[model samples]
Target: MDVLADINEYLNPTTARWYANRGIPYRRGYLFYGPPGTGKTSLTFALAGVFGLDIHVVSLLEPTLTEEELGMLFTNLPARCIVLLEDIDTAGLIRVEAPEETTESDDKRDFNVGDLTKAFKKAKKLDEALIRPGRVDHQVPFSHASQTQIKELFERMYTDDLPTTKIVIAPDSQSDVLTPPMTPISVEFEKNGHGGEESELEDIARRFSKKVPENMFSPAEIQGFLLKRKTEPRKALEEVGEWVRGMEQVFKTA
Candidate 1:
Protein backbone atom coordinates (compact mmCIF):
# COMPACT_ATOMS: atom_id res chain seq x y z
CA MET A 1 0.00 0.00 0.00
CA ASP A 2 2.75 2.42 0.86
CA VAL A 3 4.44 1.49 -2.37
CA LEU A 4 1.26 2.06 -4.34
CA ALA A 5 0.72 5.40 -2.63
CA ASP A 6 4.26 6.40 -3.42
CA ILE A 7 3.73 5.34 -7.02
CA ASN A 8 0.51 7.30 -7.08
CA GLU A 9 2.30 10.39 -5.90
CA TYR A 10 5.11 9.81 -8.34
CA LEU A 11 2.65 9.63 -11.23
CA ASN A 12 1.00 12.86 -10.25
CA PRO A 13 1.29 15.63 -12.82
CA THR A 14 3.24 17.74 -10.37
CA THR A 15 5.67 14.93 -9.77
CA ALA A 16 6.03 14.41 -13.50
CA ARG A 17 7.07 18.03 -13.84
CA TRP A 18 9.46 17.55 -10.97
CA TYR A 19 11.05 14.65 -12.82
CA ALA A 20 11.14 16.68 -16.02
CA ASN A 21 13.01 19.53 -14.32
CA ARG A 22 15.61 17.08 -13.04
CA GLY A 23 15.85 15.33 -16.47
CA ILE A 24 14.77 12.10 -14.82
CA PRO A 25 12.30 10.08 -16.88
CA TYR A 26 8.85 10.03 -15.27
CA ARG A 27 8.31 6.32 -14.81
CA ARG A 28 8.23 3.52 -12.27
CA GLY A 29 8.78 -0.23 -12.50
CA TYR A 30 7.72 -3.09 -10.29
CA LEU A 31 8.37 -6.79 -10.46
CA PHE A 32 5.84 -9.25 -9.03
CA TYR A 33 7.65 -12.55 -8.69
CA GLY A 34 6.28 -15.77 -7.26
CA PRO A 35 4.93 -19.20 -8.11
CA PRO A 36 2.11 -19.28 -10.62
CA GLY A 37 -1.48 -18.90 -9.29
CA THR A 38 -0.28 -16.69 -6.44
CA GLY A 39 -2.45 -13.71 -7.57
CA LYS A 40 0.34 -11.74 -9.26
CA THR A 41 -1.72 -11.00 -12.37
CA SER A 42 -4.81 -10.44 -10.27
CA LEU A 43 -3.01 -7.74 -8.31
CA THR A 44 -1.96 -6.04 -11.56
CA PHE A 45 -5.55 -5.88 -12.76
CA ALA A 46 -6.63 -4.58 -9.38
CA LEU A 47 -4.03 -1.81 -9.63
CA ALA A 48 -5.24 -0.86 -13.09
CA GLY A 49 -8.81 -0.59 -11.84
CA VAL A 50 -7.81 1.54 -8.89
CA PHE A 51 -6.15 4.21 -11.02
CA GLY A 52 -8.69 3.89 -13.86
CA LEU A 53 -5.80 3.36 -16.24
CA ASP A 54 -5.57 1.05 -19.22
CA ILE A 55 -3.12 -1.87 -18.96
CA HIS A 56 -0.88 -2.29 -21.98
CA VAL A 57 0.43 -5.85 -21.83
CA VAL A 58 3.33 -6.50 -24.21
CA SER A 59 4.85 -9.89 -24.80
CA LEU A 60 8.53 -9.70 -25.64
CA LEU A 61 8.48 -13.27 -27.01
CA GLU A 62 6.23 -12.46 -29.97
CA PRO A 63 7.70 -13.72 -33.24
CA THR A 64 7.76 -10.31 -34.90
CA LEU A 65 8.65 -8.25 -31.83
CA THR A 66 11.69 -5.98 -32.08
CA GLU A 67 13.50 -3.50 -29.89
CA GLU A 68 12.21 -0.58 -31.98
CA GLU A 69 8.62 -1.79 -31.60
CA LEU A 70 9.12 -2.20 -27.88
CA GLY A 71 10.45 1.36 -27.57
CA MET A 72 7.58 2.70 -29.70
CA LEU A 73 5.02 0.98 -27.46
CA PHE A 74 6.52 2.48 -24.32
CA THR A 75 6.95 5.92 -25.88
CA ASN A 76 3.30 6.07 -26.94
CA LEU A 77 1.74 4.88 -23.67
CA PRO A 78 -0.70 7.22 -21.93
CA ALA A 79 0.45 9.37 -19.04
CA ARG A 80 -1.26 7.09 -16.57
CA CYS A 81 -1.11 3.43 -17.58
CA ILE A 82 0.57 0.17 -16.68
CA VAL A 83 2.92 -1.47 -19.18
CA LEU A 84 3.08 -5.22 -18.47
CA LEU A 85 6.09 -6.94 -20.00
CA GLU A 86 5.36 -10.61 -20.45
CA ASP A 87 7.85 -13.51 -20.54
CA ILE A 88 10.66 -11.34 -19.23
CA ASP A 89 12.70 -14.36 -18.15
CA THR A 90 11.71 -17.11 -20.59
CA ALA A 91 14.82 -16.40 -22.67
CA GLY A 92 17.88 -18.48 -21.83
CA LEU A 93 19.77 -15.38 -20.71
CA ILE A 94 19.68 -16.70 -17.17
CA ARG A 95 21.36 -19.89 -18.48
CA VAL A 96 19.00 -22.19 -16.51
CA GLU A 97 19.05 -24.78 -19.32
CA ALA A 98 22.08 -23.83 -21.40
CA PRO A 99 25.42 -24.93 -20.06
CA GLU A 100 27.17 -21.82 -21.46
CA GLU A 101 27.37 -18.92 -19.03
CA THR A 102 25.73 -15.62 -20.01
CA THR A 103 27.99 -12.60 -20.39
CA GLU A 104 27.57 -8.78 -20.40
CA SER A 105 26.39 -8.84 -24.04
CA ASP A 106 23.20 -10.77 -23.20
CA ASP A 107 22.25 -8.15 -20.59
CA LYS A 108 22.39 -5.37 -23.22
CA ARG A 109 20.62 -7.47 -25.89
CA ASP A 110 17.11 -7.14 -24.37
CA PHE A 111 14.89 -4.19 -25.25
CA ASN A 112 15.59 -1.44 -22.75
CA VAL A 113 13.12 1.43 -22.18
CA GLY A 114 11.49 3.74 -19.65
CA ASP A 115 9.60 2.56 -16.58
CA LEU A 116 5.96 2.75 -15.33
CA THR A 117 5.91 -0.96 -16.04
CA LYS A 118 5.29 -4.33 -14.39
CA ALA A 119 6.38 -7.88 -15.09
CA PHE A 120 5.30 -11.23 -13.68
CA LYS A 121 7.57 -14.26 -13.63
CA LYS A 122 6.79 -17.64 -12.07
CA ALA A 123 9.81 -18.27 -9.89
CA LYS A 124 10.70 -19.20 -6.33
CA LYS A 125 14.18 -17.69 -6.51
CA LEU A 126 13.78 -14.96 -9.11
CA ASP A 127 16.62 -13.58 -11.20
CA GLU A 128 18.21 -10.46 -9.72
CA ALA A 129 18.49 -8.88 -13.15
CA LEU A 130 14.70 -8.67 -13.36
CA ILE A 131 14.62 -6.35 -10.34
CA ARG A 132 17.86 -4.36 -10.53
CA PRO A 133 17.27 -0.80 -9.21
CA GLY A 134 15.90 1.62 -11.84
CA ARG A 135 14.94 -1.10 -14.30
CA VAL A 136 12.45 -2.65 -11.89
CA ASP A 137 12.36 -0.48 -8.79
CA HIS A 138 10.22 -2.67 -6.52
CA GLN A 139 9.75 -6.41 -6.09
CA VAL A 140 6.64 -7.96 -4.60
CA PRO A 141 6.66 -11.60 -3.52
CA PHE A 142 3.56 -13.78 -3.69
CA SER A 143 3.82 -17.11 -1.96
CA HIS A 144 1.33 -19.54 -0.43
CA ALA A 145 -1.24 -18.08 1.88
CA SER A 146 -0.12 -17.48 5.43
CA GLN A 147 -2.22 -17.63 8.62
CA THR A 148 -3.07 -13.94 8.45
CA GLN A 149 -3.95 -14.06 4.76
CA ILE A 150 -6.06 -17.17 5.35
CA LYS A 151 -8.01 -15.40 8.06
CA GLU A 152 -8.52 -12.35 5.88
CA LEU A 153 -9.69 -14.48 2.98
CA PHE A 154 -12.14 -16.31 5.21
CA GLU A 155 -13.57 -13.06 6.54
CA ARG A 156 -13.84 -11.53 3.06
CA MET A 157 -15.63 -14.58 1.69
CA TYR A 158 -18.31 -14.71 4.40
CA THR A 159 -18.92 -10.99 4.64
CA ASP A 160 -21.36 -10.24 1.83
CA ASP A 161 -22.72 -6.81 2.72
CA LEU A 162 -19.53 -4.89 3.17
CA PRO A 163 -19.66 -1.29 2.00
CA THR A 164 -16.84 0.22 -0.03
CA THR A 165 -16.00 3.90 0.26
CA LYS A 166 -14.29 5.59 -2.65
CA ILE A 167 -10.82 6.67 -1.62
CA VAL A 168 -9.31 9.59 -3.51
CA ILE A 169 -5.53 10.15 -3.46
CA ALA A 170 -4.62 13.34 -5.21
CA PRO A 171 -1.13 14.69 -4.50
CA ASP A 172 -1.32 17.68 -6.79
CA SER A 173 -4.60 19.36 -5.90
CA GLN A 174 -7.59 18.85 -3.66
CA SER A 175 -9.92 19.16 -6.66
CA ASP A 176 -8.28 16.16 -8.23
CA VAL A 177 -11.03 13.86 -7.08
CA LEU A 178 -11.45 12.21 -10.45
CA THR A 179 -8.64 9.65 -10.32
CA PRO A 180 -9.14 6.76 -7.87
CA PRO A 181 -6.60 5.74 -5.25
CA MET A 182 -4.28 2.69 -5.01
CA THR A 183 -7.00 0.47 -3.57
CA PRO A 184 -10.66 1.31 -3.99
CA ILE A 185 -10.58 0.98 -0.26
CA SER A 186 -8.85 -1.52 1.97
CA VAL A 187 -11.85 -1.99 4.24
CA GLU A 188 -10.55 -2.93 7.64
CA PHE A 189 -12.99 -5.74 8.41
CA GLU A 190 -12.78 -5.49 12.18
CA LYS A 191 -13.25 -1.72 12.34
CA ASN A 192 -15.93 -1.58 9.64
CA GLY A 193 -18.39 -3.77 11.49
CA HIS A 194 -20.34 -3.47 14.73
CA GLY A 195 -22.86 -5.47 16.80
CA GLY A 196 -22.92 -9.14 17.81
CA GLU A 197 -23.34 -10.53 14.28
CA GLU A 198 -20.05 -9.00 13.15
CA SER A 199 -18.30 -10.38 16.22
CA GLU A 200 -19.76 -13.81 15.55
CA LEU A 201 -18.54 -13.66 11.97
CA GLU A 202 -15.07 -12.61 13.15
CA ASP A 203 -15.03 -15.48 15.60
CA ILE A 204 -16.01 -17.87 12.83
CA ALA A 205 -13.21 -16.57 10.57
CA ARG A 206 -10.71 -17.07 13.40
CA ARG A 207 -11.88 -20.62 13.98
CA PHE A 208 -11.64 -21.37 10.28
CA SER A 209 -8.12 -19.94 10.11
CA LYS A 210 -7.03 -21.99 13.12
CA LYS A 211 -8.41 -25.20 11.61
CA VAL A 212 -6.32 -24.69 8.46
CA PRO A 213 -2.61 -24.92 9.09
CA GLU A 214 -0.53 -21.81 8.38
CA ASN A 215 0.81 -21.34 4.84
CA MET A 216 -0.18 -24.87 3.87
CA PHE A 217 -2.91 -23.88 1.38
CA SER A 218 -3.06 -21.46 -1.48
CA PRO A 219 -5.64 -18.70 -1.18
CA ALA A 220 -7.44 -20.02 -4.25
CA GLU A 221 -7.86 -23.43 -2.60
CA ILE A 222 -9.41 -21.95 0.52
CA GLN A 223 -11.53 -19.60 -1.58
CA GLY A 224 -12.82 -22.56 -3.54
CA PHE A 225 -13.99 -24.18 -0.34
CA LEU A 226 -15.62 -21.00 0.96
CA LEU A 227 -17.28 -20.37 -2.39
CA LYS A 228 -19.03 -23.72 -2.16
CA ARG A 229 -20.31 -22.77 1.29
CA LYS A 230 -21.03 -19.15 0.45
CA THR A 231 -23.38 -17.28 2.77
CA GLU A 232 -23.22 -20.32 5.07
CA PRO A 233 -20.56 -19.18 7.47
CA ARG A 234 -21.56 -21.60 10.18
CA LYS A 235 -21.55 -24.50 7.74
CA ALA A 236 -18.10 -23.48 6.46
CA LEU A 237 -16.74 -23.35 9.98
CA GLU A 238 -18.14 -26.79 10.71
CA GLU A 239 -16.77 -28.41 7.54
CA VAL A 240 -13.39 -26.65 7.37
CA GLY A 241 -11.64 -29.17 9.63
CA GLU A 242 -12.66 -32.08 7.41
CA TRP A 243 -11.80 -30.07 4.32
CA VAL A 244 -8.30 -29.28 5.65
CA ARG A 245 -7.64 -32.91 6.46
CA GLY A 246 -8.81 -33.95 3.00
CA MET A 247 -6.62 -31.30 1.39
CA GLU A 248 -3.63 -32.50 3.40
CA GLN A 249 -4.18 -36.05 2.17
CA VAL A 250 -4.56 -34.89 -1.39
CA PHE A 251 -1.33 -32.90 -1.22
CA LYS A 252 0.60 -35.78 0.32
CA THR A 253 -0.60 -38.16 -2.38
CA ALA A 254 0.34 -35.70 -5.11
Candidate 2:
Protein backbone atom coordinates (compact mmCIF):
# COMPACT_ATOMS: atom_id res chain seq x y z
CA MET A 1 0.00 0.00 0.00
CA ASP A 2 2.86 2.37 0.73
CA VAL A 3 4.18 1.71 -2.75
CA LEU A 4 0.83 2.68 -4.22
CA ALA A 5 0.78 5.81 -2.07
CA ASP A 6 4.27 6.74 -3.18
CA ILE A 7 3.31 6.19 -6.81
CA ASN A 8 0.26 8.38 -6.31
CA GLU A 9 2.48 11.13 -5.01
CA TYR A 10 4.92 10.72 -7.85
CA LEU A 11 2.16 10.91 -10.44
CA ASN A 12 0.76 14.13 -9.02
CA PRO A 13 0.49 17.08 -11.41
CA THR A 14 3.29 18.92 -9.63
CA THR A 15 5.72 15.96 -9.78
CA ALA A 16 6.04 16.09 -13.59
CA ARG A 17 6.78 19.81 -13.46
CA TRP A 18 9.41 19.16 -10.82
CA TYR A 19 11.09 16.60 -13.12
CA ALA A 20 10.83 18.92 -16.11
CA ASN A 21 12.25 21.85 -14.09
CA ARG A 22 15.23 19.66 -13.11
CA GLY A 23 15.91 18.67 -16.76
CA ILE A 24 14.82 15.05 -16.25
CA PRO A 25 12.51 12.94 -18.38
CA TYR A 26 8.92 13.09 -17.14
CA ARG A 27 8.34 9.30 -17.15
CA ARG A 28 8.61 6.58 -14.49
CA GLY A 29 9.15 2.85 -14.83
CA TYR A 30 8.46 -0.14 -12.56
CA LEU A 31 9.93 -3.62 -12.53
CA PHE A 32 7.49 -6.35 -11.45
CA TYR A 33 9.50 -9.54 -11.85
CA GLY A 34 9.47 -12.67 -9.73
CA PRO A 35 8.62 -16.37 -9.76
CA PRO A 36 5.67 -17.70 -11.71
CA GLY A 37 2.16 -17.24 -10.23
CA THR A 38 3.35 -14.61 -7.79
CA GLY A 39 0.94 -12.00 -9.24
CA LYS A 40 3.30 -10.20 -11.61
CA THR A 41 0.74 -9.63 -14.34
CA SER A 42 -2.05 -9.25 -11.78
CA LEU A 43 -0.31 -6.41 -9.95
CA THR A 44 0.56 -4.71 -13.23
CA PHE A 45 -3.12 -4.73 -14.18
CA ALA A 46 -4.09 -3.54 -10.70
CA LEU A 47 -1.66 -0.64 -11.03
CA ALA A 48 -3.20 0.28 -14.36
CA GLY A 49 -6.68 0.02 -12.83
CA VAL A 50 -5.79 2.27 -9.90
CA PHE A 51 -4.30 4.96 -12.14
CA GLY A 52 -7.12 4.64 -14.71
CA LEU A 53 -4.66 4.00 -17.54
CA ASP A 54 -4.96 1.69 -20.52
CA ILE A 55 -2.22 -0.93 -20.83
CA HIS A 56 -0.14 -1.11 -23.99
CA VAL A 57 1.70 -4.43 -23.61
CA VAL A 58 4.58 -5.11 -25.95
CA SER A 59 6.36 -8.42 -26.08
CA LEU A 60 9.78 -7.81 -27.54
CA LEU A 61 10.24 -11.55 -27.90
CA GLU A 62 7.15 -12.05 -30.05
CA PRO A 63 8.39 -14.06 -33.04
CA THR A 64 6.73 -11.98 -35.74
CA LEU A 65 7.64 -8.58 -34.29
CA THR A 66 10.64 -6.72 -35.67
CA GLU A 67 12.48 -3.61 -34.46
CA GLU A 68 10.64 -1.43 -36.97
CA GLU A 69 7.22 -2.68 -35.80
CA LEU A 70 8.27 -2.17 -32.18
CA GLY A 71 9.04 1.48 -32.91
CA MET A 72 5.78 1.81 -34.82
CA LEU A 73 3.82 0.38 -31.88
CA PHE A 74 5.39 2.84 -29.48
CA THR A 75 4.85 5.72 -31.91
CA ASN A 76 1.13 4.91 -32.21
CA LEU A 77 0.50 4.52 -28.45
CA PRO A 78 -2.08 6.83 -26.81
CA ALA A 79 -0.55 9.87 -25.17
CA ARG A 80 -1.68 8.82 -21.68
CA CYS A 81 -1.38 5.09 -20.85
CA ILE A 82 0.56 2.33 -19.07
CA VAL A 83 3.30 0.89 -21.22
CA LEU A 84 4.07 -2.71 -20.22
CA LEU A 85 7.33 -4.05 -21.61
CA GLU A 86 7.39 -7.40 -19.86
CA ASP A 87 10.42 -9.68 -19.40
CA ILE A 88 13.11 -7.66 -21.10
CA ASP A 89 15.71 -9.96 -19.53
CA THR A 90 14.38 -12.91 -21.51
CA ALA A 91 14.20 -10.96 -24.74
CA GLY A 92 17.94 -11.34 -25.49
CA LEU A 93 18.32 -7.59 -25.51
CA ILE A 94 21.54 -5.90 -24.52
CA ARG A 95 21.54 -2.33 -23.40
CA VAL A 96 22.34 0.07 -26.22
CA GLU A 97 22.95 3.76 -25.56
CA ALA A 98 20.38 4.88 -28.08
CA PRO A 99 18.53 8.09 -27.37
CA GLU A 100 15.62 7.46 -25.01
CA GLU A 101 12.16 7.76 -26.49
CA THR A 102 10.35 10.97 -25.54
CA THR A 103 6.64 11.74 -25.58
CA GLU A 104 4.62 14.84 -24.81
CA SER A 105 1.98 12.55 -23.27
CA ASP A 106 0.82 13.15 -19.72
CA ASP A 107 2.12 11.23 -16.70
CA LYS A 108 2.07 7.43 -17.21
CA ARG A 109 3.29 4.27 -15.50
CA ASP A 110 5.85 2.10 -17.29
CA PHE A 111 6.13 -1.56 -16.25
CA ASN A 112 9.05 -3.78 -17.21
CA VAL A 113 8.73 -7.31 -15.87
CA GLY A 114 12.30 -8.65 -15.37
CA ASP A 115 11.56 -12.25 -14.21
CA LEU A 116 14.23 -12.09 -11.51
CA THR A 117 13.27 -15.11 -9.38
CA LYS A 118 16.61 -16.81 -9.06
CA ALA A 119 18.00 -15.80 -5.69
CA PHE A 120 20.83 -13.27 -6.15
CA LYS A 121 21.50 -13.92 -9.81
CA LYS A 122 19.03 -11.14 -10.62
CA ALA A 123 21.84 -8.72 -11.38
CA LYS A 124 23.78 -11.26 -13.39
CA LYS A 125 20.86 -12.44 -15.50
CA LEU A 126 19.32 -9.05 -16.18
CA ASP A 127 21.39 -6.75 -18.36
CA GLU A 128 22.25 -3.29 -17.02
CA ALA A 129 21.33 -1.62 -20.29
CA LEU A 130 17.71 -2.80 -20.15
CA ILE A 131 17.03 -1.34 -16.67
CA ARG A 132 19.47 1.55 -16.44
CA PRO A 133 19.46 4.15 -13.64
CA GLY A 134 16.82 6.44 -15.15
CA ARG A 135 14.91 3.83 -17.20
CA VAL A 136 13.44 1.89 -14.25
CA ASP A 137 12.36 3.95 -11.26
CA HIS A 138 11.40 1.10 -8.90
CA GLN A 139 12.09 -2.60 -8.57
CA VAL A 140 9.18 -4.35 -6.91
CA PRO A 141 9.99 -8.00 -6.32
CA PHE A 142 6.87 -10.19 -5.86
CA SER A 143 7.94 -13.08 -3.70
CA HIS A 144 5.78 -15.96 -2.40
CA ALA A 145 2.91 -14.99 -0.12
CA SER A 146 3.69 -14.60 3.58
CA GLN A 147 1.59 -16.11 6.42
CA THR A 148 -0.43 -12.94 6.83
CA GLN A 149 -1.06 -12.75 3.08
CA ILE A 150 -2.13 -16.40 3.03
CA LYS A 151 -4.59 -15.81 5.87
CA GLU A 152 -5.99 -12.72 4.20
CA LEU A 153 -6.41 -14.65 0.98
CA PHE A 154 -8.47 -17.28 2.79
CA GLU A 155 -10.71 -14.75 4.53
CA ARG A 156 -11.32 -12.80 1.32
CA MET A 157 -12.80 -15.84 -0.43
CA TYR A 158 -15.71 -16.24 2.04
CA THR A 159 -16.31 -12.58 2.86
CA ASP A 160 -19.63 -12.55 1.00
CA ASP A 161 -22.73 -14.78 0.98
CA LEU A 162 -24.17 -15.91 4.31
CA PRO A 163 -23.14 -19.32 5.52
CA THR A 164 -25.89 -21.90 6.21
CA THR A 165 -25.59 -25.66 6.60
CA LYS A 166 -28.54 -28.03 6.24
CA ILE A 167 -29.47 -31.30 7.95
CA VAL A 168 -31.44 -34.22 6.41
CA ILE A 169 -33.19 -36.84 8.52
CA ALA A 170 -33.35 -40.44 7.36
CA PRO A 171 -36.82 -41.99 6.78
CA ASP A 172 -36.51 -44.75 9.40
CA SER A 173 -33.83 -43.34 11.72
CA GLN A 174 -33.88 -40.24 13.90
CA SER A 175 -30.23 -39.58 13.19
CA ASP A 176 -29.56 -36.28 11.39
CA VAL A 177 -27.37 -36.26 8.27
CA LEU A 178 -25.52 -33.08 7.44
CA THR A 179 -25.42 -31.74 3.91
CA PRO A 180 -23.25 -29.06 2.32
CA PRO A 181 -24.94 -25.68 2.01
CA MET A 182 -27.32 -25.64 -0.95
CA THR A 183 -26.33 -22.29 -2.44
CA PRO A 184 -27.71 -23.10 -5.88
CA ILE A 185 -31.35 -22.58 -4.84
CA SER A 186 -31.65 -19.57 -7.14
CA VAL A 187 -34.03 -17.22 -5.31
CA GLU A 188 -33.53 -18.85 -1.91
CA PHE A 189 -29.76 -18.52 -2.20
CA GLU A 190 -30.00 -14.80 -2.95
CA LYS A 191 -32.22 -14.24 0.08
CA ASN A 192 -29.92 -16.28 2.36
CA GLY A 193 -26.83 -14.33 1.36
CA HIS A 194 -25.42 -11.87 3.89
CA GLY A 195 -22.01 -10.41 4.39
CA GLY A 196 -20.36 -13.29 6.29
CA GLU A 197 -19.34 -12.97 9.96
CA GLU A 198 -16.00 -11.22 10.18
CA SER A 199 -14.94 -12.55 13.62
CA GLU A 200 -15.66 -16.18 12.70
CA LEU A 201 -13.93 -15.78 9.35
CA GLU A 202 -10.86 -14.30 11.01
CA ASP A 203 -10.64 -17.19 13.48
CA ILE A 204 -10.95 -19.74 10.66
CA ALA A 205 -8.37 -17.86 8.59
CA ARG A 206 -5.88 -17.86 11.45
CA ARG A 207 -6.29 -21.60 11.91
CA PHE A 208 -5.86 -22.19 8.20
CA SER A 209 -2.79 -19.97 8.10
CA LYS A 210 -1.18 -21.94 10.93
CA LYS A 211 -1.43 -25.19 8.98
CA VAL A 212 1.08 -24.13 6.35
CA PRO A 213 4.60 -22.80 6.56
CA GLU A 214 5.08 -19.12 5.91
CA ASN A 215 6.24 -17.84 2.50
CA MET A 216 6.28 -21.34 1.04
CA PHE A 217 3.43 -20.95 -1.41
CA SER A 218 2.51 -18.16 -3.78
CA PRO A 219 -0.77 -16.27 -3.28
CA ALA A 220 -2.12 -17.77 -6.47
CA GLU A 221 -1.35 -21.30 -5.29
CA ILE A 222 -3.13 -20.85 -1.96
CA GLN A 223 -6.07 -19.15 -3.69
CA GLY A 224 -6.31 -22.10 -6.05
CA PHE A 225 -6.63 -24.51 -3.11
CA LEU A 226 -9.20 -22.33 -1.39
CA LEU A 227 -11.29 -22.15 -4.58
CA LYS A 228 -11.52 -25.95 -4.61
CA ARG A 229 -13.17 -25.77 -1.17
CA LYS A 230 -15.19 -22.68 -1.99
CA THR A 231 -18.40 -22.06 -0.01
CA GLU A 232 -17.09 -24.54 2.60
CA PRO A 233 -15.06 -22.53 5.08
CA ARG A 234 -15.19 -25.26 7.73
CA LYS A 235 -13.96 -27.83 5.24
CA ALA A 236 -11.08 -25.62 4.15
CA LEU A 237 -9.95 -25.03 7.74
CA GLU A 238 -10.04 -28.75 8.53
CA GLU A 239 -8.34 -29.94 5.34
CA VAL A 240 -5.60 -27.36 4.97
CA GLY A 241 -3.09 -29.58 6.77
CA GLU A 242 -3.57 -32.48 4.36
CA TRP A 243 -3.55 -30.10 1.41
CA VAL A 244 -0.29 -28.52 2.62
CA ARG A 245 1.35 -31.90 3.02
CA GLY A 246 0.28 -32.90 -0.48
CA MET A 247 1.63 -29.64 -1.83
CA GLU A 248 4.90 -30.10 0.03
CA GLN A 249 5.39 -33.55 -1.43
CA VAL A 250 4.67 -32.25 -4.90
CA PHE A 251 7.20 -29.50 -4.39
CA LYS A 252 9.82 -31.89 -3.04
CA THR A 253 9.46 -34.24 -5.99
CA ALA A 254 9.42 -31.41 -8.45
Question: Best TM-score goes to which candidate?
Answer: 2
Collision pairs in model 2: 162-194
| Model 2 residue 189 distance off true place after TM-score fit, in angstroms | 13
Please give the TM-score that candidate 2 achieves against the real structure.
Answer: 0.73
Q: What ranges in model 1 sit over 4 Å off?
A: 59-71, 86-128, 162-195
**lDDT, model 2:** 0.71
**Consecutive 10-residue window with the lowest summed lDDT within model 2:** 105-114
Per-residue error for 44 in candidate 1, Å, reads: 1.8
lDDT of 1 by residue, 22-107 (tens): 99877898877654556777888888888888998877678798879878887898778888876666643342433245555332
Residue lDDT tens for model 2, 42-124: 87789889999899888878899998988899789876688888767668864333334545321121112222353323333
